[model samples]
Target chain A: MAAAEAAGLIAVGAGLAVGLTGLGAGIAEGNVGAAAVGAITEDASLFGKAMIFMVLPETIVIFGLVISILAIFVM
Target chain B: MFKRSVRKGNYAYTVTRVKAKKSHLLREEDYDKMIQMSVPEISRYISEAGYQKEMADLAGKYEGMELLEHATYQNMANVFNSILGASQGELATMVSAYLEKWDIWNLKVILRGKSYGLTGNGIKEDLVPAGKIDEAALDKLISLESIDDILNEYSRMGKVKFPADVISDYKESGNLGVIEDYLDKLHYQRLLDSISPYTQPTKIFLDYIRRDIDVVNLRTIMKLKSEGIYGEKVMKYYIPGGMQIDSKFAQLLANAETVSAAAGDMSRLDVFEEYIKPVLDFDNYDNKAVVSAIKKYQEDQAKKMAHMYPLSVLPVIDFMVHKETEVRNIRVVARGVNSGLGRETIKGLLVI
Candidate 1:
């Protein structure tokens, strides 16, 4: 019973690790994406550059995912 | 008590779009080339650039310098209207309020036109229609028969109201100077009152406007002082709420015996040293040169603020100022070319 409770707490921690970072990435990307789309509407040639900026925040979520995987499997 | 939340506008999108539009404005090289071109050639050049629609639309009615002038004005109106449309919430409110001067300008044009016995078409040519009063409403106002009728119609439709005794005052004095001064004051007063300074961006924006007021007051002081007007008489022309030119400073500047003396007093202030001092220090000061220097300083300050706060109204305001300068520059070039002025002379007239 004690082990089960500890495992459940670890699960919650892992969930939060991914969830909070994903939320942060989403907020960051929302701003970049809006600006990117605005620029793209004005000049279609900027699409590739805008896309690169739009993808920059995704790395944060990837980092969170790595941490979550380690917390669940390697721990 | 319920607290109202501070409403935010879509700064990211608006700023980005404005940046893109700003990039498309005429560059220094373009101005250099335009200086050598004839009026028709310049018109064609602009038409090929970004003003294709305006050029095409106005081509039927106007030609030569008039064509360029009308096209640039129409394009400016369209650009301002688009910015107003793209902005939301607080940004929209600020932009619309800033553009409200155009409304006052249009009304003054109509009043002046009516008094001068100008026809509707003649009056319409001068109107910009960039404010809350759109082109159609301006057309309707122009169609009105008399000055009183136009004023009545405008008061009903416009956001601002004419004084209750304005018509009577006009009749009594037969001078629109009183009414025109009242409108100018009303524009600045309304602008100051509408802004709340709720956020950092707003605080900076308010500071910019106060600086603008200071510039205007300084210009007025220089003009009045040159005319040998002083003290309380100068105070009548002063519009308050400047960043530096307070009542005390205004009085000090006003009481100066000459224009250079007034400028010397102004130079003691750090802010005025760069733009104001060099231009006004000499006797027989060219008003146009002083105005241009002030405009350049304002533009530089705006560019700095816009850089510091990218996702704010500063970028938009900067773009608007630059766009107006572009239109003005093009008009100068066109007019200079039409008047058979030399390239160097025309270049001197350009602000760029």
Candidate 2:
């Protein structure tokens, strides 16, 4: 019973690490995406530059995913 | 009671779009090149540059200075209207309110046109319908026979109500100055009332408005002082709510003996020390120079605020100011070139 309860808590922690970081990344990317689209609409040459900015925040979510994988499998 | 929802505006999108448009405004080199060109060549240059549609549409109807004037005004209206269209929620409210000055300008034109017995089309050509008042409403107002009729129609539109006594005062005095002053004051009053200075962006916006009021007040004082008119009469044209020029400060400036004395007194204030005072010094107080210096200072302040708060309404406002300056500079160059003014004279007139 003790071991089962500890496993359940660990699962919740892993879930939260991924879920909260994903939400944060979504918010950060939303603003950048809006600004990027605006710039691209004005000048087509900016598409490459805007695309880079649009994906910059996505690395945060990757970090969170790594932590969650380690928590679930490596633990 | 129901809770009021907080309004959110698309700041990121609007600011980026505005900055993009701002980048396309004419640079100093463009003006230098324009100053050397003749009127027709200048017109062609601007046509090639962002004003292609307006120039093409108005080309057959007008020529030379007239063409430049109409095209620039049309482009201004289109650009301002586009900005208003792009903005939403709180941003929309603020931008629309700011552009109401054009409404006042249109009203002044219509009233002056009616009083001068100008034909409807003649008056229509001068009006820039970029305000809350649509082109159709302006057309309807222009078709009205008398000034009183126009005022009544405007008030009936449920936007802003003109004081009943304004018409009576105008009839009694036969001067449009009274009505114009009232309209100017009304514009500022409405602007102040519309803004709530609660958040950081809003607080900065309010500060900008106050500074604008101060600039207007200082201009009036300087103009009147240059004309040797002062004392109690000066207070009549005074606009309240300036950041620095309060009623007491204005009274003090009014009591100063000469224009240089007034400039000296103003120099004590931080804002005046840098750009305005040196121009208004005893040796060089030409009205045109003073006006241009003040404009340069105003543009710098706007640019500073826009840089400081990139995601706020300041960027939009900054773009509007720059767009107006571009139109004005182009007009000055066109008129000067056509009139055979010296290049130095025309360049001096430009704010670039």
Q: Name the 10 consecutive residues with the lowest summed lDDT in model 2 chain A.
A: A26-35
Q: Which stretches of candidate 2 lie over 4 Å from their true place?
A: B1-6, B156-158, B281-285
Candidate 2 structure quality by residue, lDDT tens digits, B1-352: 0122125677888889899999899999999999999999999999888999999999899988999999999999998988888887788888888899999999999999999999999999999988878899999999999777888887775277778787678889999888888888888888877777877887888888888888888888888888888988888788888888889999999888678778667876556877776666566558777888888878888887888778888899999999999999999999999999999999988898
Q: DockQ of every model listed?
A: 0.80, 0.74
Q: For each candidate, what is the lDDT?
A: 0.84, 0.86
Per-prediction interface RMSD in Å: 0.5, 0.5
Say which candidate scores most in DockQ: 1
Q: Over the full model, what C-alpha lDDT does candidate 1 score relative to the true structure? A: 0.84
What digit string (tens of lDDT, one per residue) describes model 2 on residues A1-75?
998998898899888888998998988887798799889878989999999999999988888889988988988
Deviation from native of the Cα of residue A33 in model 2, angstroms = 2.6
Residues B1-352 of candidate 1: C-alpha lDDT, one tens digit per residue? 1122125677888899999999899988999999888889999999987999999999999987888899999999998998898888677888888898899999999989988999899999999977878999999998988877887888787656877786678789998877887777788888878677977888888888888888888878877777788888888778888898898999999888887667667777645778766666465767777777777777777777887789888899889888888999999888888899999977766767
lDDT tens digits by residue: candidate 1, A1-75? 998998898889889989999999987987899799889988999999999999999999999999989888988
